[model samples]
Target: MEPNNDFEIFLVATPGLEAPLHAEAVEQGFADTKPVPGGVTCRGSWPEVWRANLCLRGANKVLVRLGGFPAVHLAQLDKRARKFPWAEFLRPDVPVKVEATSRKSRIYHAGAARQRIEVAITETLGAPVSSDAAVRVLLRIEKDLCTFSIDSSGEPLHKRGHKPAVAKAPMRETMAAMFLRECGFDGSEPVLDPMCGSGTFVIEAAEIALGLRPGRSRSFAFENLPSFDPNAWSSMRQQQPLAKPDVVFHGSDRNSGAIEASTKNADRAGVADFTMFQTRSVSDIKPPSDAAGLVIVNPPYGARIGDEKRLRSVYGSLGKVLQTKFKGWRIGIVTSNAGLARSTRLPLLPPGPIVDHGGTKIRLYQTGVLT
Candidate 1:
């Protein structure tokens, strides 16, 4: 690869949800998009990196895999690291954080490897090293091959910068957006989250419907890179005409605090006019008076809702509400327990594969338009 050549751009997807993210990448017209084990790989320039961070809703992070080489020992790694063109990718002024992982390799001390890379950047490239820096340089030593990549997303993309008041076990924006896409929601129909916590799903739905960019309110680490072009990027970041949806997205939660957080979050995200949040339990929740659309909920699967015995009643109420009141509306319920889902008694189709939610495993159980 040339000094300034485009490398592999990996759009990191949440584990077990790679297919939907890959589908999103392909739909977004990313060139040479192919889903790898941990992420979707594509080829694009630095501007493409910015665009990926800006537009890809399902990506957790965008990693630029600058080419790797075989290194059997720390000395060889040090020599090559010192010679690599860090000045081309990293600015001398911006601080950097170096993280490493070793798997089945001789140079297996991840801490030592990270230290060497950090020294190389600080000493050889004249950059300050910081553990908390937003721009991260990642080193992976696997089977004696050392690969380096840069994390373009300083904060996780799910932060969205606009939503600071989140409820317990809040669904990540990235995961919610993909689940929304998986449910065949393309901003054409209304969306409601009866168990909306912090309004992540509702806000994401409104953003999608309004054609708002997820990263619009956030700054990316890519802006600190050596290749960053402010003028071109600013011109590219120019807002497209937003679409006005015909139906309002809605979210309801039994907790008044959750309702407050959701409402405030929607306002910060600039989708307040397109969203409605209310304090209501599942039993009291009903579909909008006139609109029949998709009902997507992320209920508490753990003890937050209640003990297992008590949760059966809660799930049952949710199921009963959808079954009786939401006729002709589609439903997508995300939870960790199959039994809890079964208690809902809604005709749930087979769920998609299990998704990693922090440490817990969850799945989205879907239903067709209800009877």
Candidate 2:
């Protein structure tokens, strides 16, 4: 495998939400876009990889495909790994972590494969192999072929670096952004979340509408790569100036603590002016008068033993409020229990794919404009 000037950028996606991620890559003007099972792959330069980390909201992580070759055994893999031009992508001073996965390959022992690559990087490139290294080199061996990639995002893109406050089972920023995309929000319309745990949905929506880069407040693994040009990256990052949002976003919760957390989070995100959070129950929620947009909520499903029954009243009351109000506004409800969503009696369309939220399986149920 030889390092080249051209390469593929793999945008790691949250499983079951590949469609929205794929759509996002295409919309963001990435080239040769294609969707795979766990992520989306596109072709670009190193700078483009940097841009993907900063811009794409739906991407969980960004990986740069280094190269690949065929290897039938451990000896062949070790020999090839050493000759793969580790210097082209890795520096001798920085540490790296090598991870390997094997399936349907002659080199079935992933641990041994990882050991070989770690030795190769250490001996050939003079780089230390640390378990806690931010720079990760991933090796995937399938059908006697080995492909290598570098994780350009050190921290998951969801961190966004600004949101320190979170609620129990708060939705990852990546997942929240995808759901907003699935709901057809293009940043021009207002968004509302009644049960906005830590205001994930509300903050994400405000960022999108205002053209704020998710990576603006964070650092990426690509900064340490051999090919990275700090001046060029700085120029690229500063080229796109922020824009003011035309419409305001809203988030409310019955818990006063949740409201306080959301307010602090929104202010830290620099979207407090364009967004609002308040301590209010679902039944008291009211739509803004100016614009009709999407209402999205990630409510608790109470999937544990005897928990669903207790949550029925919450869903029922939420439905009553939205049905009578919020005309012409789209709605999306994310919950694990289909029974709980049905109790709302809102005209929900077919469910989206089952997504892994922490450990529980959840799906998004949407509706046409509420009549």
Candidate 3:
């Protein structure tokens, strides 16, 4: 069969959360979604790839798979690399970096494999390969099959280009987004992060609610690609809906510094006008004017926050506050320690799945009622 112009988009997520990421990709309009072990695969063009980078919140990075070919040895690898349409993706003036990883394949020497691919790209396309280049091309060899992909997103999408400072063990933007999706955030209702450390969850929630593109404020690696069409991208940008949201989004933290950070991040994301930040402990949390909304909390865990026993008490106190104050609201808690979460004493459904938070496995706990 002939190769199609379709680009394979890899939505990188925490290990074991590929299904959720795949569902998210489909929900965002990418038709064909296949769940991989550590990520999801979808087909699209360069524009769709760009849009995914802008819109996907649960993805760690967006990799554009260029092509795949069978290569058992260096000789086959070099020949296949030379045949790839390097000129179509890389410009002579733009420097490119080749990164390679090998597993269970004859191409054992990763450094040598990268050098061969780099030489092929430079010699065939007349483009200089530099280690410090802004444009990066990734090569993966598994079981004598080589897969090539271009890093469309320069920085990981989790960076979000807004958070300058983070509290101890802060939840990553991608993880927070996944938790929100698991909690059923459809961007229609209000979201609350009661223990909003640096405000990542609240900011991401507000951005989703307002239909703001996460990648709008950052530059992408694909912008330097040879086939990049600035005019088409501008047209796409112009066509994006600018509708404002009409729901209340609130975040509060016991630490004043965290509240300040949340406020700054929301402002930087241009959703500050729609989000409310306050320096209040979870014990003091009060529901916003809305009859029902989400209460998502990423509280201090044993790894980051010391004294698990005392923290359990804090969680118990939090449970009391939620049950007494907000009865009809939905509650979602992100925590690495399941026991700590159970300390809340709220009847929670079985956690959806485990996600990686800085190498620790975290799960979501939800209360049946908001209160």
Candidate 4:
């Protein structure tokens, strides 16, 4: 495969977040970005694929389509797979993990299809197949057409490889970045999270403000590909000069353990200089600066109604504190329960698209600059 050859690059997004991810892709200058059901598709070469994994904060995984063929039976699939130019993209020494999914097609046995592809790669391409390999080859046999792609991102982008500590039901960095975008935070102004868990939102805001790339400290699966150029990748990963922001991002929680975790995570992320985490209750929280910005919080809510009812007072206290202390700052509250959001009684606009945080469905209830 040519290093500059253009192909389909699929950016897997959290369900219900395709639009925001598409918008982020467009902003990052990806070619022909279009939002689909579970992801956004674009066309780019190998360098673009590497850059996508390196820079796109909202993408969960980046996949590059290798090639495909119409195969109706197992024999045809095996034949076509054996002829695939895998050596051009994959190294013989690198172990590869193959996974297959079949939908609405005659070749409905996913396990059988996966076995065939694995055999083809092992025998024809001379690459060992391992279930635990960092490099992944995905085969989707949909509608009798087999499409092969390589997962360019080894681990999920949200991992960031820096945060080792987390609070209960902590928000993911990818989701937090998109939600910050949805809240109209451009990283110029301060961001305060009163119920900050693990300091995800606060640290993310600080990083954005500092113009830091989310994947700067992590390694990607693309490094194992034959097309990878070490010198070029090293130059690309070299971070540009970053200027310190004038505003400081703030996070506060009642739990001292959460505060400690947030501090450690921030230091690891290299944004501790621009962030402040305090062990304080919602009612004790105060703005860090005179300038008005965004106060975004993902308050805790429960699955059971009784737990939800008990949390109403907590939500009410949060809303009351914000109303009394933060006059001009806008607010964004994330919760699974509409009732808990209603308890805030802030002048909220329509809630955003439902986002799947782990397994729970949550929405961002946003407000304009508060009165």
lDDT of each: 0.90, 0.91, 0.83, 0.92
Of 2 and 3, the candidate ahead on lDDT is: 2
Off by over 4 Å in 3: 1-4
Ranking by lDDT: 4, 2, 1, 3
**TM-score for predicted model 1 compared with the true structure:** 0.97
For all predictions, the C-alpha RMSD in Å is 1.3, 1.4, 1.8, 1.5
Tell me the deviation in Å of residue 32 in model 4.
0.8
Error at 368, model 3, angstroms: 2.1
Taking all chains together, the TM-score of candidate 2 against the true structure is 0.97
When 3 and 4 are scored with TM-score, the better candidate is 4
Model 3 residue 49 lDDT? 82
Badly placed stretches (over 4 Å) of model 1 are 303-305
Per-residue lDDT tens digits for candidate 4, residues 125-208, read 789999899999999999999999999999999999889999988889999999999999988999999988899999999988
lDDT score, candidate 1? 0.90
The RMSD (Cα, Å) of candidate 2 is 1.4
Candidate order by decreasing TM-score: 4, 2, 1, 3
Better of 2 and 3 by TM-score: 2
Compute each candidate's TM-score over C-alphas. 0.97, 0.97, 0.95, 0.97
Clashes of 2: 0
Clashing pairs in 1: none
Please give the lDDT score at residue 272 for candidate 3. 80
